[model samples]
Target: MNTKIYCLEQCFLPKNWELLLSAVKNVAGFCKESGKYDIPTLPVKLGHSLSKCAKVLRTKAIMEDNEDVKKSVEGFLKLYEDEWNERISVKARQTLYDAKFN
Candidate 1:
């Protein structure tokens, strides 16, 4: 994710469409790696920050009139949605425990 975010930052340079595309690819790669880890929980703050980053990139792509960047942003958004859905909350854990115990 850090790598993805770094790539995203590089995408901000004016007329650097390649960098923007790379950033979007990196985000997808990071998401795939995260799934392999099967992380049970994610910090809410981190999630929010990532979400914000995606939103910013999306808007930037649109503003720049880059269709390829926009497509990449859509890919990143899909990855974000999948990753967030997999995240477990404390309440969810408690519910699982109760189900198992009862």
Candidate 2:
């Protein structure tokens, strides 16, 4: 079995199972290498820059035939961005105290 496939299956929370899959569908290439891209893994800071950087990195990784987990994070970021934009009717930064997760 593929390592990425296995990890994608084993990892993620039970409550977020569906959301995670939805996230993975949006981000096809996700692996540790792309996860190392200069962004903080912490939740807050990661959420802030994740959507943009993850999209670019994941797209590149897919082109290179490599999987990058950061891409998955990017998918989640986009979901939140879309939801927020829908609710507030504004494209703006909503979070504060930028930090991260590891």
Candidate 2 lDDT for residue 46:
31
How accurate locally is residue 101 in candidate 1, as Cα lDDT from 0 to 100?
83
* Candidate 2 structure, TM-score to reference: 0.27
Predicted structure with the largest lDDT when compared to the true one: 1
* lDDT on C-alpha atoms for all candidate structures: 0.50, 0.39
Residue-wise C-alpha lDDT for candidate 1, range 1-102, written one tens digit per residue = 223335554443334433433443343333343332222232334455656886788798799998776776676566556644454233334444555687
User: Which 10-residue window in model 1 sums to the lowest lDDT?
Assistant: 34-43
**Residues 27-69 of candidate 2: C-alpha lDDT, one tens digit per residue:** 4322344332222223333344444554666676677876454
Model 2 residue 32 lDDT?
Answer: 44
Query: Relative to the unseen true structure, what is the C-alpha lDDT of residue 4 in candidate 2, on a scale of 0 to 100?
Result: 38
Q: The CA-based lDDT of model 2 is what?
A: 0.39
Runs of candidate 2 exceeding 4 Å displacement: 1-48, 67-74, 86-102
- Residue 40 error, candidate 2, Å: 21
Hey, what RMSD does candidate 2 come out at? Answer: 12.9
Clashes per prediction?
Answer: 0, 12
